[model samples]
Target chain A: MKVTDEILNRFIDGELNSEELKEFKDELNNSRDVQTQLRALQAASVSFKNIKEDSPAVDFTSKLMLSLHKKFKSRRRDSIFIASVASIFVVISLLIIVYILAQIISAAGPNSSFQPGLQVADIFEKIAQTFVSKFSSSSVSIVGTIISFGVIVSGYFYFDFLKSTRSN
Target chain B: MIKLTDSEIIESIKRGNQSDYSILVDRYKNKAYSLLKRMLKNNMEAEEVLQDSFLKAFQALSNFKGEAKFSTWFYRIVYNTALTRLSTKKRKIEMEMSSIDDYEFLKSGFDIHSNEKEDTAKMVNELINRLPEKNAAVVSMFYLDEMSCEEISNVMNLNVTNIKVLLYRSRNILRDMIVQNNLVEELR
Candidate 1:
């Protein structure tokens, strides 16, 4: 079998199997061409080893770290912004739900039946009754649903912000 | 001083010890710079792209799964960033280079006759620099970085067979040049 340059290349790279290795050795012992080719390849390989790696400027690390620091700061600012927006959204949603409840209670004339100040339990019952009564109104249901969805979405964003901050 | 593995360092960075990243940066900077320098053939551009590659790796670190070695992943970033820079400079070639005829490929930039007085290493470096971009990267990564063919395949996004072929062909060219110049003895 004729030994090709590819064979020699694989041989030098130690990619040959045990059978191929034996055949290559036999060929190497017999052929001057194979020997010369192997010699040249080995020389080239050694020359490649002489090529040194290039170094960057002295400040490369410092500059990269500075950029990373900026990136972290920006990321923190974004997390803070998300948290603030989500907090504001949750607060607004709660206020709207409270306002809707108060409007329903006032419309029900609960103050006339309860006298001046009502117990917490009575107030909750009146709010629940009025809420159930108005539950059939599509506008009321939608407003309630929109507020709940907004709050849930805001909670999700807030959770995501916490996760991101912790990971960073 | 017990040295931490790349994964350890990455975990530390992910855990908010971002400063530990400098260790990785220092570790890979030179070898990666060598790769970029050979790929771009411009020291200034190589350094600039090296920085960009590092920043990109840092930004994308959270997405790195440990399926491959860190060197493999990092070099992939470097190789791709260099390719992008090359394309922006309007010098990017097809990554699938096996179809190009060897003669046409050799005729493009196989000039070894220039500067005959340089030493073997310098001559070898010059010859590698004169090769096609992908070919030069294969030689550099294979030898200078001491990366295996599989690792180079991962970085270059080529199949292992193609990488082996490129490596063999490139080393053969260097061998032929060394033989012709009678630099084989000096190299040994």
Candidate 2:
């Protein structure tokens, strides 16, 4: 019978029945190759079993926990900071867009007489109205836009971080 | 007073009991560190990989389905982490070796009468380290960590049969190396 890997592994593991063991021993006695293979297996096992276990340096756990905590905290803080910065940018952009639109509307209005007193009053009223209306609408739009973009960008960064981290 | 299982510890971590994660870390860190040390053969790299593995395990703990033992799952993370480090280092060394001769060079000085057993063990360890990365991993997991073939299979994502075959092949290779080095005499 051909000495199959399954049989050899079982022999190595000492998992054969008494009769199977007898047959295997007889086969081993007849086959030089089988005897050499068995000896090699035994020697390898002996060498492997002799490997020594080395302990990690003292304070490994404490330092690891501290570092993990700091990493988690930094990641959380970075995400929050990015979101806040993005929100601020969106708010500023909306405010600038609103201020320009108000200026364009006021300059295009029918009250274009440039008499000093009336011009000053009209300009004041226009400035106040623009501030009030634009502040309200821009606040809503800026907050909405900021939230959406912030979420998308933060999500992308988070996933990228996770992917890179996993591979490392 | 209630006892906690690995699953329970994981659940507690998911519920925001972040401190409970230390239990999980404490449980697997040493084993992970040991495996990395053998795989990378560098203490600093092993420690970094160990920390990275634990951080990963903690982050992904919620997704753990209890299909495998927690140690097995954690080992997979550690194994992958160490393999990446080894591969990167291997690439750097391969580039450097292009300029050097292919043949082995003698050390500046040799101790002619080193203790035979100690020399043998050192030679054996070197040969084990020289095995294909996968085989080295299998031998390290099996022999160094005292893990069973099934556990190795889980960590390695291989079938148990494949693990058995790999283990057999690796043992044969190691034996051949030992005999070639004259560490052990061939049986007559």
Candidate 3:
């Protein structure tokens, strides 16, 4: 039976069965070619084994750590900024709701005591009138455009922050 | 200080000891860099990819279930990062090479043209670097990392049988080169 390089590879890898091992050993005892092949394979294996690991740049770890630190700091700032913005939005929303409710209550009951110098309802009417009378369609459209741009920029930063946090 | 296990260091990093990650980095950087150097065949690109790999691993550390060894998981990042860089450079790495044609091509194509006598180790190293990217990665993972074929299969996303085939074919090619160049005596 011919002992091929495949068989020798299996032998080196300890993939040979007991029967195959016995047969291979028998062949090994008789054949110089098999011995030569085995030696060559072993030498090749040794050469690989002798390979030294290549180091990265000397500052690799420090540079990575510095970047990580920067990411952490930036994420912290983003978190704080998002939290502040959200808090302001919630507070403003609640104040507006309370102002509207107070206006409704005052309008419904003449005896209601909550009264600001400028009534919220009148302010809303005046603002609506101003938009309708003084603001041109193009001006209103410009305002809408500005609002849309603001929303888009905020959304972009929010998603970008989320991505940064998740990746970090 | 006692050397912390990779798992222990990872735990510390998870606990907010971000600096502790440097321990794992120091432990793996050289070996993983070696793997990248072989796969990318350019030291600068390899180093850049290695840094990116470490960043990716750190980012994904929370998802590490520790089901596999850390080295296996980390090397997968290293391998994939180098692969992406290679793709970006439009360098196609052959994943599957026909055994007979690959063996014959490697055997005939390996020519060490330098007339100056070279060390066997350096000669063998150059031969290894000349291997196809994926094949070189397998050899590096197997010998440099001392990883088993199973672990290599995990990192390379190939079946264990395929990994063995790559390993065997690579070794045979290296064996032929060694024998042809009369380097076995030096190894002996």
Candidate 4:
């Protein structure tokens, strides 16, 4: 039998057939390389097998679970915080736009005659009438646009939810 | 309490039973911790990285395809995490493979070694820890975890043949350590 390192290793580990094993044993007595390899293998395996397994610290599980819980909770909190910030931003932008438009309207004083004795109610009624008439003409298109945007956003979220579920 | 397969538990975890993840943590923490400690060679660092690996695994659990065994998959993550952590310290490790050829053979094969050699035997695992990363990992997995080379190949992402070769080289290195340290009692 032609003995090689891998073959010799297998023989030491009892992996060879009986016929080959005998041939290797016969060769071992004469070959320094084979004998040396076998001794080395034996020493390594015998020592390694004797070492004990180590268990983690007693608080290992609790510590891991606590960390995981904190991570999950923190992620939830981050998403909520982002959503809150976004809504606050939208509300603030709307308030700023209303303020600007109100300033523009006030800058362009009511085109009606300022009868010095005109009641405050009469001026309020006039402003309300002009505001509705100005926007009422395109209300249908504006409502259509808002409804289309709502449908698209909802559809996008629904599809996203579907994709996540399907992947899971 | 019915025993649930890992994949089944994984399915439930994906279905929103997040707490079920604790079962996996409980099951694999020892193994994961042990391997990490072997790789990192530090208990506190191993504990921290172990948590990171588990947390990352849980976060990415949705992507698990259930094709490989869960342990294999999870261990891959742990291995990669250690690999990343090791990269930071890789430059600092000065390997002393200087006297490899000086290894002596046991006289006419192994002799009547006794409990007296227990100290050197004890240093065997420590010697293993000092091997190069891939070699050390293969040795730890094969010996400590009692895993097959095939399973280790999956975890380490190396082919079985290559792993075996590395394992053999690692054994020789270990053998040389045992000899070079003059731990063996005698040549007879």
Best by TM-score: 3
Q: Number of clashing pairs, model 2?
A: 0
Candidate with better DockQ, 1 vs 3: 3
- Provide the lowest-lDDT 10-residue window in model 4 chain B: B99-108
User: Which residues of candidate 1, in runs, are more than 4 Å off?
Assistant: A89-93, A111-168, B94-118
Task: Give per-residue CA lDDT, model 1, range A1-168, as digits (tens).
Answer: 679988898899898999999999999999998888899999888788788888999999999999788777868788779798799999999996787567557755835653324444566677698788777676687879889999999799878966866665
**Model 2: colliding residue pairs:** none
Each candidate: what lDDT? 0.82, 0.72, 0.83, 0.73
Off by over 4 Å in 3: A110-127, A133-168, B93-100, B103-118
* DockQ of every predicted complex: 0.62, 0.30, 0.73, 0.28
**Candidate 2 lDDT, B50-134, residue by residue in tens:** 8888888878887899988887888898888877776777753653353212213211122314545557676656655555556
Report the candidate with higher DockQ, 2 versus 4: 2
Q: Is candidate 1 or candidate 2 better by TM-score?
A: 1
What C-alpha lDDT, on a 0 to 100 scale, does residue A159 get in candidate 4?
A: 78
**Predictions ranked by DockQ, top down?**
3, 1, 2, 4
- Model 3, residue B4: displacement in angstroms? 1.4
For A1-168, candidate 4 gives per-residue lDDT tens digits of 677767766765677898888888899988887777677667777776665666678887787777777667766766776798699999999986676566455645778544433434455566688767766867867866888999999799767855654443
**Tens digit per residue, CA lDDT, model 3, A19-119:** 99999999999999999999999888887888878898999999989988888788788889989989999999999788777666667576766555546
Candidate rank order under lDDT:
3, 1, 4, 2
* TM-score for chain B of each model, two decimals: 0.87, 0.71, 0.89, 0.78
lDDT of 3 by residue, B22-67 (tens): 9998999999999999888889998889888988999999999899
- Clash counts per candidate, in order, are 0, 0, 0, 0
